[model samples]
Target: MKVSTHQPSGLSAPGLPSPSLFSSLLFSPSLFRPYLWLAAALVASPLLFSSPALAHHFADLGQMKPTLSNGVLSGLAHPLLGPDHLLFLLALSLVALQCRWGWALGLLLVGLLGGAAGLAWPGLPGAEALVACTLVVEALVLLRRLPPVLLLPAIALHGYVLSVPVFGWSTMPVAAYGAGLLLSQGSLLLVALWLLRPIAKRLSPANLRWLALALAACGTTWAFSAWAG
Candidate 1:
């Protein structure tokens, strides 16, 4: 009787080393995708449960003082302090990756400029409700359920609303505040978009889906909190 041996399809020979663990994880859809989603969900959980009062407090910083330094600090602190705004920018970073390079910068410019101009515009009624709605709309657009065209107007509207609190009813020059707004939001946008460019590459499409889902959850939480208030 004679015996024969067979080799596996991908292997060159019996003793060759297999692929590295990092490469295997990087390439394996079955292994890391679910874990990434779980991690994202866990990260978003705190934002969902945070106090609703914080949203009101941070969104309106003009009550402190109208000084230049204060304005700059307030501007820097608003987004970082408010989960609603921070998450909004995070979602925008991801969405902008799919848009033109100037898209994110344009939105920031429009927002800061609109806020500066919002001083003259008569206070828009139901502005709070509208701002809350923008989050939901943004999430929808990110998930590709809504047209991207709507994003510009929505962000402009948010800028206008944000100005009311930051500048209040004061007629003073907003040069400093405007500069601060630009600096704070611009820095965040640049960093977030920069970071997300690589992340979007590394993450599987399925992992990206979960990130969108997490954003939607955060938006829903903020909207509900705003509505309750």
Candidate 2:
């Protein structure tokens, strides 16, 4: 025994012409309810993933809070937990993937050392501002398909930025910290390379402008906030 069910028009069966065929006859909004509902659901799903907010790269492990290990190793590893530092480093590593491995590694090492040295001797100003700006500038290059370069001077400058301790972690011996920092930053480089592989394939020339605009916007917002206080 077959039960007669009222399937939505185009979804119906047997002699009833396809819904679009009777478009003139069935012009009611109710006839399009299923598709409208599907579209609404599709749009809303992304918003659902949007809430509670995804954590930043280094955010989950109490990163912003100071590490209390009270030793040189801990001091070197402190930046690992700071989301700002992690994100910037990760972005640098990933974006640098466009260049040769030697250049990429050299740039990162130089930047890392420069950051360390800046802290070892605090003569320069605006280290934080420069770090923030670096991210913004790098994003523009990413959008433009430009190669990432680590000029010697810029590497020296990054060291200055990393030296800025949010509070009083500045008393640690700077030289002793370099070895530990090398290890820490190396991990960042590895992860960045791994993640960028897929992105390299998926990115397209046409989207570069929009991507740059979005990155620049993110960088500007972050830089403005860093500058504000």
Pick by TM-score: which candidate is best?
1
Runs off by more than 4 Å, candidate 2: 1-72, 145-147, 150-155, 165-173, 206-211
**How far off is residue 13 in model 1, in Å?**
42
In model 2, what lDDT does residue 55 have? 21
Give lDDT tens digits, candidate 1, residues 25-94. 5446786678966786687678788843365445354456666676666667666766766777878887
Best by lDDT: 1
What ranges in model 1 sit over 4 Å off?
A: 1-43, 51-53, 56-63, 168-173
Model 1 weakest 10-residue run by lDDT:
17-26
Model 2, residue pairs in steric clash: 114-159, 115-159
Candidate 2, residues 148-229: lDDT per residue as tens digits? 5533455456555555542234344443444455667777677566655555555566655655564455556555655665
Name the lDDT value of residue 143 in candidate 2.
60
Our tally of clashes for model 1 stands at 0
TM per candidate: 0.73, 0.57
